[model samples]
Target: MNSANGSAWDDWDDEVDLLVFGAGAAGMTAALIAHHEGLNVLVCEKTAAVGGITSTSGGTTWVPGTQLSVDAGVPDSVDDARRFLQSVVGARGGDAAREAFLQSGPLAIDELQRISDVKFVAAAAHPDYVTGPGAAFGGRALAPLPFDARVLGKDFARVRPPRKEFMGLGGMMVNRNDLGALLSPFASVGNLKRTLEVVGRYCVDRLSYPRGTQLVMGNALAARLYYSLRKRDVPVRFDAPLVELIREQGRVTGAVAGSADGSRRRIRARLGVVLATGGLTRHPVLRKQLFPVAAQPLSLSPDTHTGDGIASALAAAARLEDGGDSPGLWMPCSIRRAPDGNDHVWPHIILDRAKPGLIAVNSRGERFVNESNSYHDFVMGMLRDAGDGQSVPAHLIVDAAFIRDYGLGLLMPGRSRARIAEFERSGYLVKGDTLEQLASKLGVDAAGLARTVQAYNRDAAAGKDPAFNRGASPMSRFNGDPAQKPNPCIRPLGDGPYYAVTVWPADLACSAGLSGTANGEVLDANGAVIPGLFACGNDLASIFRGTYPGPGTTLGPAIVFGWRIAKFVAGKLDQAPAGERSRATACANQPS
Candidate 1:
């Protein structure tokens, strides 16, 4: 089966319906839908592994204005969700993208559940970014399947753990309150017991399941699809990156790829190619190109997301549409040095909303924007010039009392206290006994820092935070402890030995990508579709422009469009005239 040149002739034939480029969440989701729709599907992954960023992400897919809200007895309409998206995304997003997402999201979720191993839980407390005017309060985000990893067996080694694992507890069934309770030590006994039970059951599943069958979120989706395809003896060769798209007469006929052994082999796809390889997060060149000054050595995605699939598709004459432009971008991340001397990057920390008494500042020692705003707003403020047309790196300032009373954003209370203490001793965290002393140590202006704190404290004590308006929406529930009546997220700066950590606006990835239609069709620079090509996930222009409308926004649209592209292609194949016998045969094998 495998040639000495390292190329395996995998039943190569010109009679397949779908060719999926990446096995990430979106691609895998599409594969399941297409396969169940009676299409012959072939998925190729560049890495030795299958799951992409979804495996390493928080694993929560944010889909706003979904029917799940309706089924749950919450009143959320597609029309209302569309209005909110327009407000957040502005004119960049129009009727096409909005309509596509709303129309397909519920079906996507439902279909995945019926055919795959998905166990979704509605977000009980995570509100749409736009909550006040025509926004759902707590029904947009969907958690991943709560699966037992034992199902994966040997395959488990290939799956990447979520970069932020603490957030993935509660079997993908967690409500916002469940998540908050998980974060809080004083109020987590019940949640803790339940979490232990879930872990116990997961351990059992791993022990009893087949070596290649696992039930974790990304692994669950991947395993279920893998099992289905494997049942039919479909071949999956890993470490096989798409080298080129084989073309004939301006249509994609097949592809050539490089396998793990460094040999190239050609495979034919009679129908079409689906590129769901995800974004270029791990591609430093792309990162620096998109965000010149945000930070270096940055990436929230796993090292596997090198944008190879995107590049290969472009080379095959697939034009990428311009995606959401960068604005109000916020990384809101945590940084700690790895043992290898490189920094461990963590992005999109929602804890800023739960903890109130803290504020973020640039290197110039001044508040730049609302620390509690959406991640988009938070990062954009950091990217702004700190007056006088000079650039300023940012740092986060938190009081000792604040940390003790309310907790640091991601560093849970019990563990965070010790970690902060260690960081202080190690010089990563700066602390001093007095306001002026702390400012002096951190190389910031003592008088200005003190004045800022004084004004903030004065306003907070009066039950009014005019500077930033910390608590503005339901999303800010974790701003601070409810026990602190006045300014729950705000506290006076006098409790000496203050603290500061050099912070940067970390990004999940560049959300700005090639623009695409709702059906995941990439258009030319002139806005004309180049038939036989499609895109989804970060590789496609975001339907909500750049701003995250809610928790599952990225995953929601990616899966929807992936399905949409397959459905569209299938429909076309089914309608082809009978005279075109050879073409019809190819189309028949692809899927409909």
Candidate 2:
């Protein structure tokens, strides 16, 4: 009954009740659930590090109707969430898949919190990215509560580090709340105390470690999952990539994986295989087919996500979802090459664009969108304004006052002089004594720049943006500094020393992938289930059908479906023969 590359069953290296691929949040969650169900399980990671892009992400999950939201006094229900999804997703995604995600999301969170070390808190102040029907001011998005990486002990080294550009003070990881204290240490006694405590801890950590051990966001989520796995005694093989899936009687039964040194091992899974690889954003051919704009050199996803899961599933007759409005979730990112000859990307998620005194302009120096919009919408504006690639590299213009309070791109706030000098030296930022000079340096039209700034300043002074309405939305105000007068998202670009940073369209996640059933079974071209094969995370086609509904949309569904697939596999394992169960358990106890 063995299939795939003609690998003989006699050469099988190991066996387990379930095999999970890609060791990100989704994969790890699946493994944890399988172990909880008393099934023998194994996890395979394609890269040296287990946390895929999730480790470097914001680590927020948009799971509505959760206990955390209720405990935080935020009103949310399944009906309201369904309405929200209907308004945003329309009819693109199947009703079954969407309904399953909505129903399973809160349950997944509740179960994980009850059974594992995972903890979540409601983001009460965060608003949905778009102000549409059924959108809530809060309660929909949940973020992982900050976790202490020291809990992992020496295993902390296995956790992937956050992007260098995202950290501060030589790799000290700061959360959103701590960032405010760090930015304004003199604001109050409480602020000063918080700053001292954080800095003191960071200084102590740096004495021995390359980066601070206080994990936040994606790293915190990954660390918690890894900790849970270790506690459950789950065996995870790093640098092991799936090469082929073995089919028995038209059902997936096992897989062959290759090590970094080209050594191969066959693993027999008695129940099923779960594909949770991040997604297809880094695949060259797939990118060409999926992306609307010219292929750019930047992607926010980890390099390990190259459609491995999608390719493997499709090869086994799995179907791919079609009719997504956009094939990817995008972010506006800036690139800077370091002395090490590598290009570093900084995603402008919430730092600069919405703040006062900053404007984004196309090549002609004309504003095309509300600059205070979400990162996803900002890139959509760029794509729309990109006529023949003219706006491919849009410029974000900010004045010296803005840079001092809220740094542009990789330049941190408050320390403008030294950081700006370093940025200019690296050619990552352009500076000018006047708007005209800045336009000249950026290759934008001088007259257009002057006219645009003049009109914007007049609007800022009047506290009204008649052109784009930058400060009109709740989402915009959430990301803005409320201490400023009239409008938080609008201010006049006063005198001189204007700065410009080049921004490119970068994908944050693949919005389209292998089509699967609600329980995670891969679907064939005719919509029949490909038995024993399942997918979650970016490996599964997005439930939103390409719309960025809110923060954590990518992660929420990933966790829900991973949980669902584990439950489904557990049911199948319960029905298997005693000999099969014993053999799987025997293999699981064997040393890797």
Candidate 3:
């Protein structure tokens, strides 16, 4: 979206109090908040569906000191979260946005629930990704409560589906909590009961729905926000991408949107236009300039993201900023040809990596990082090792026992036996009758692979990881199998007939974007706010300066800033303090 040609537009085809450039969590949330304040809002979605990449995410929100935490009786305070952020990200450029996020997170949550259909439940045992001063073992991260997609009736189809690889049983979206029950239905009566109910519901749902109607994780969050908008009758134009920002005498006041019929319409926002168009992940030019060339950056964001909002903002005098520790939040994604013959990318975020009996190896077949660490951290390790470009396309070496016990990516436990040949044929799963054969097939140094495995096995037996401390962190242990050993994250390589999956660093979202303020105002290069121009979601530079602190880091800030943008436009940005903020300030004010 460029403003050079947009300046010629004269009359408006449509008008609203607020115009949102995306239909993702950030944009939808902003529209919802603005609609609640009696502002007429319209959302333009680039794709046919409502959710962006977030619909495929884990749907966690790491906002501290909410009623959900108190209701769950989870011990947490905002001050602790603040200190945790400070430890992980010291003196970042977006400190104002960070403090604003901390102060307004709980308040935003409260305001959202009071006015919209959004709901969250405190996670009982979610740990922060990094351990630092005042780090939370739990309580800070909350998950979206599972949403019954049937509420939307036919409109449910508009909610984007999760990645094909992430789903089970032909589009059944089984969440983490119910996975064990589904995997081992007869193991216990409770398991059997839940499995039966779940499967039975899916069977009935398939009669009319393309997928199961019970949605969880990011899908649920997206659906909830979408339903809130629908309830308010807010108009959302699908397949409409922002073409350009309409600046009236230096302030962004509207946008030109493109329709599927190849028509363009100037939609004016009486209050302001909010840029929330995913991010620069798919932008042809910006991706190269910002991403590390050595790391071979890939993105999980939608194809339609393509820098529409950011480009439009830049054309309107909004400045883009970069130079963070990392250009984007990353995951080690395993790619394979799916049943539909499309290349499927599975983000190795939580499953199997931290489990026993798997070690990630570079081209030389040596471990370069802690396999049990967070996905973002793990990919950062990959970038560090691959800066010279020789260590990339790392393989996750696993024994047959590891597959049997904890299935590799896209392979459900016990299901690999039937699909192994197909996956192997597709070059997705590499199998070896012996370690040497596997190393040769994977083009890894056989001698190096042997030595690495030997050292890892010795360390596993002793329940220690002196090299990288794989299982030392609380978060690492949380991702591991607790039943296994003294170190839940470590186990020796089992009997041969090993397998390996190739992985590459993929960004889940861009860390850099248009410079913006705590009030959601996009700024010029001189640090002055561009009047009436606001950016949220990934359109704004990350508040943490590219440091991933915990689960829901992306969604938490997006949702909060969405609310802040709406409040600012409605002239109520400084409304009476939420009780949650007072508690947070009180905790921060108290002496050590």
- Encode model 1's per-residue lDDT on 356-426: one tens digit a residue: 56766554566777666666566666666534422245666777766665545444444566687776675
* Model 2, span 1-592: residue lDDT tens: 3454544574679999889999999999999999999999999999887788889999998898888888888967888888988988887756777888887788889999999988899878788888778888888889998888877777888888988877888788899888878888998999999999998998998887778998899889999999999999999998899888888657777888889899988898877889998888887788777787543567888877888888888788888874287788889988988988988788898989889899998889888888888888888888887767767789999988888889887887887487789999999989999988999999998999899999999989977799998888888988888977889998899899888899999988888889877778788898777767889999999888878878998989888888988876776323221122222233223443
Candidate 2 local Cα displacement, residue 516, angstroms: 0.8
A best-first ranking of the candidates according to their lDDT comes to 3, 2, 1
Task: Give stretches of model 3 more than 4 Å off.
Answer: 1-10, 294-297, 575-592
Better of 1 and 3 by lDDT: 3
Per residue, candidate 3 scores C-alpha lDDT tens digits across 380-441 of 88888886654577899999888878889877676646687777888899999999999999
Question: Candidate 3: lDDT of 238?
Answer: 93
**Highest lDDT: which candidate?**
3
| 419 Cα displacement, candidate 3 (Å) | 3.3
lDDT of residue 309 for candidate 2: 83
Best by TM-score: 3
Kindly provide the TM-score of model 3 when superposed on the true structure, using C-alpha atoms. Answer: 0.94
lDDT of 3: 0.85
